[model samples]
Target chain A: MKSEYLSEYDNIVRTMQLYIDGCKQGKSELMRPAFHPNASFFGYAGEQLAIGTQFLFDWIDKNGPAPNIEPRIVSVDILDSIAVVRLEVAEWSGKLAGSGVRMSDLFTLLKTPGGWKIIQKAFHWHAAEQRLAA
Target chain B: MPERNTPQKTLESWKQIAAYLDRSERTVRRWEATEGLPVHRHEHERQDTVFAYRHEIEAWSRLRTASPNPSSVDGADTDNLPAPTPIVNKYLVEHDAITRTMHRYIAGARAGDSDLMRSAFHPSATISGYCLGVEYTGSVEHVFQWIDENGPAPNINPRFARIEIIESIAVVHLEVQHWSGKLAGANARASDVFTLLKRNGEWKITHKLFHWHDQ
Candidate 1:
């Protein structure tokens, strides 16, 4: 890969790391560097679409003085100025502990003038019963 | 033979017409019904023998697919078509975002993660597909809720056969190998077609139409 592409890739991975680490540490401010002001999050808690990062931030505020999170970057794909990162997290602590849900996060990032910033975050959740079979 | 651009070159039967178009007769028939593909009947032969003009089929395909130009089509002027290298490169570059969207979709389905699936589509999108030989049509939210309540298929492997983008609109042909909790032991293969739009520099699925193979 070209050096420019590699640099961009590294920057994106680092940006995503900041967001996940922020959530784990309950430092909402850490998320600011990684996410765009207009970034939106979409996920299904049930039938509802969990929109915006504020709710997640609030949840972190309520439960995460510190969260025990094991986050892994599953894959990253980049083309031109856009990149997407697939992430999986196995958490045994915080509010999510004992919930028995397996989650996957897909973050869409753009190479902005300020640097790579996440523009959108989408996620999936699997119940514990289903996880057992898998 | 007829003059260029004129609807001549009378094809006497469906077989000959299908050969000329390089498609099955069934495909052409579906096109005629759904896409308004041109087909003419002999006035004096009592409409028994179907016929079509070669030029008309070319025009119809161009109009339906919204190609960059008709010249890029087969049998058209090869010299007039733009060079393949740069065009293909541009297409692949543009398709990167779409590929990510699809990957998110598959991951979401397999994991029973509503958030990932929601992220793959616009908020207002709707889906129409078959489940267990039954037709299902509903909002994206409804589909999400169904999956949330019922849980996702145990295994979801989606493979893409083609992704065609014309300007801001795209269509993808995908085959999904799926098996869920409710329906176990039955082979569940689904052919999914997704329509996407590029809005605000992002590609998101706007609509989905699909059918299960066994259904």
Candidate 2:
């Protein structure tokens, strides 16, 4: 693979890594550039929609900064301007400690005049009974 | 005219050879479903395992390949076609998020690994449609519930055989003659579109939808 391909892929992996790191460190500025200023974060938890960046920022701060959490990228597949990334995460919080692995993204990354930013986002995760074939 | 023995060209369709060895149709279908009909996939068409000889397949089938090919597509007894393109992939990933989640969940179903499947879902994922000819918009929990209690494994292997992953948009589509060997079995196919989020430095399935040939 060419260095360009590797970088686009790394941008995804590293960008994702940065976003989560921002949340953990309470540095909201860490994730500002990765999203549109109006970018939204959506989640379905118990029939309710968890919305907005600030909603999550507050939640993360209240949740004591989600300690001992480790997020690792399992694999990255690049196709021109689109890519899919699979990841594994572990949280070591009291009683909530658990390991979850998912292949959860189909990103449309634009190599814009400024730089790369996520233009659109969606969601899906694998079932509980699956493994990454090595 | 005497026939020349062009012993080597490269036969892509092992679908025929599997027949000669007296392998069951199920065996052949399984191979076709998984790795693809044992043909060399080119930018255009699949080539034969060897040169297009008259009696090759029949001779290998313990008969005469020359009598006539029974199932050549389009009634033409030649093996050449145009180059392959991304035609099929467009439809496959058109569902986007819904299809992505479906692939992840189906991967879970095939592997008998729950932890592996959970990533393709939200904690609230559910199967809210008809299954076994009944209409039920249930939770992703229910889908996971069934796979846990029941083994959709070897018992249903003969009919519910394989999965094909197209190289675009994370499409994982399948045909199941009997899903997990249910009493009133179904030949169901489904897909969804999905998106990812960077959660704590990791990617997670954030949205998805589904569609199935429900009974």
Candidate 3:
């Protein structure tokens, strides 16, 4: 009998670490298992549509996962195969070397064939003083 | 003799399964074929189709609570996975339910489901943002008003939003960032906890309180 909980917990951490490594390496293959083959990237990527894994891979190739961006887990809840993660992606405007956005990302992920993948992702970022002025 | 006409509420009777999973017949079939969504097994029937037991369906729904939180860098269940004080479990259950509703609401906004967006929260839902030295508070209706005034949900910034639920009660800490058109304005981000009481057997958000991180 499991007193608290087991399994999946380690798998998720491994997956998040994988994502970070993938982002750092700019290797789309690294991200392959973290997202559904049909996974879509929300938010913006210039004037084009940011849908599908190709866009994410390409974005990683171009931008490099926001330099100096670090993730901190605030809390998480897991029940069965569905889980939600709350975290703060702490970073300063100067770190990114451009328009700065500080704060965290709240996300929901589900266990999948390859491993744990993000099904839905939401973020709360701070606007840079310079960009706000512009 | 059981009430046969009451439709067994049994799992995997095509019609029943589709409704239970909130999926279309075609989608359900496809998922069954590929996603390993546990096929139904009707005793003594079927050589071509598969089915699930009612008990298993209920089992899966109950399993959602133990699902792993995959985004944590450490990827463990609260390390302690405290069983005692998770009195918080009630809060957790409610949080999960409402967040799902919120996700559907945001997604529907892309589909032009105005009714969904409007009805997602209680009519009295409210938002408050604090930053620098200023504090702002407004009704949940005002948030929608600003959304309408701006544009669609996707056009808004992905950052500056967090939704947390604790049992039948939940809270959404968020900021509205409209980048274009008239709604292209930024709303300071703050935490707003909503008390979603089980009213008449249905979870309904009654009162919502907002606060600043510093306070």
Candidate 4:
């Protein structure tokens, strides 16, 4: 990677860490900085397609903490003022104890005047058998 | 605004304008709505009618053809097309380059040849997602390895859902069905999101995130 890209990559990762940290603590406030004010979310929560960022924040508050959840940065692709990051999260505790949830998240971010902020998040909830295998 | 040294003939009604442009009234109406076709409306007590100047319509047609995706214009005349401006040309070139790169990736998947796909991706590209309830992560090389082991998927059908470009950055949404591999016997489908970047005037896939639909 070019020297400029290296710095941009680090900055993007730093922003992503905020999201991971928020998930670990189960606090939407901690994750707010990573996302734009009007950021939207799309994903399947079981059979229903969950929409809007508010739903995500509310879900985080309800789910509580998952200290054991492990998040991995799979990839970060940057182009000029836009970027996309793929994240994999495993071992996330569900409402019932011993029930784990695995998630695959794709984030689209823009280099706003303020900084890099996630503008959209699309994710998929892996099946339970996949979580158990992991 | 009307230009000098051009025909000042006024085309009355949508039908006349369509006839002048050699297009259907519906198509001309759509062009007015989406492409800013120059049309003047007369407000009358009974009904309002539209009119267009021949010169203005001709100028609009030339500008439309000079846009990045002129192929989208239905039944466009190929002769005597105006040269696109530098900015528009740049966008058109980049769009074509990105599309070719995507085709290479698809070709590689169909033939199960990692080498064919290697050129489509950056050296540091990564792939991550789940297949059959299994999490796969790490370098893009892992995908090549998996493809090699699984052999060819000549029967897989891929449809490009969307391609959004913002300067040097782009995102592609693709849906594939009848993908042959570990899930060959079963009808497997997947939705893939690929992020691309233009480096040194070349577009390459930098990241891929996918979701395999549950059977």
Ranking by DockQ: 2, 4, 1, 3
Cα lDDT of model 1 by residue, B10-108, tens digit? 776777666665566665554443334566655341123468877776655544432342222233322121223333356655676677577666656
Cα lDDT of model 2 by residue, B68-155, tens digit: 3233332332322222233344433333333334444554564444543676555533333233344333345666665665444322
Scanning candidate 4 chain A in windows of ten residues, the lowest lDDT window is A94-103
Can you list the residue pairs that collide in candidate 1?
A43-B115, A44-B115, A123-B115, A123-B116, A124-B113, A125-B113
Model 2 RMSD, rounded to 1 decimal: 17.5
Candidates sorted by lDDT, descending order? Answer: 4, 1, 3, 2
Better of 2 and 4 by DockQ: 2
lDDT of each: 0.61, 0.40, 0.45, 0.69
Give model 3's share of reference contacts.
0.00
Which 10 successive residues of model 1 chain B have the least lDDT summed? B77-86
Q: Candidate 1 chain A vs. true chain A: TM-score?
A: 0.83
Q: What is the lDDT of residue B196 in candidate 4?
A: 75
lDDT of 1 at A122: 62
TM-score of 2: 0.34
**B71-139: candidate 4 lDDT, tens digit per residue:** 234555322335533445667667656766776677677667776678788776766655665655557
**DockQ score, prediction 2:** 0.07
Error of 3 at B102 (Å): 5.2
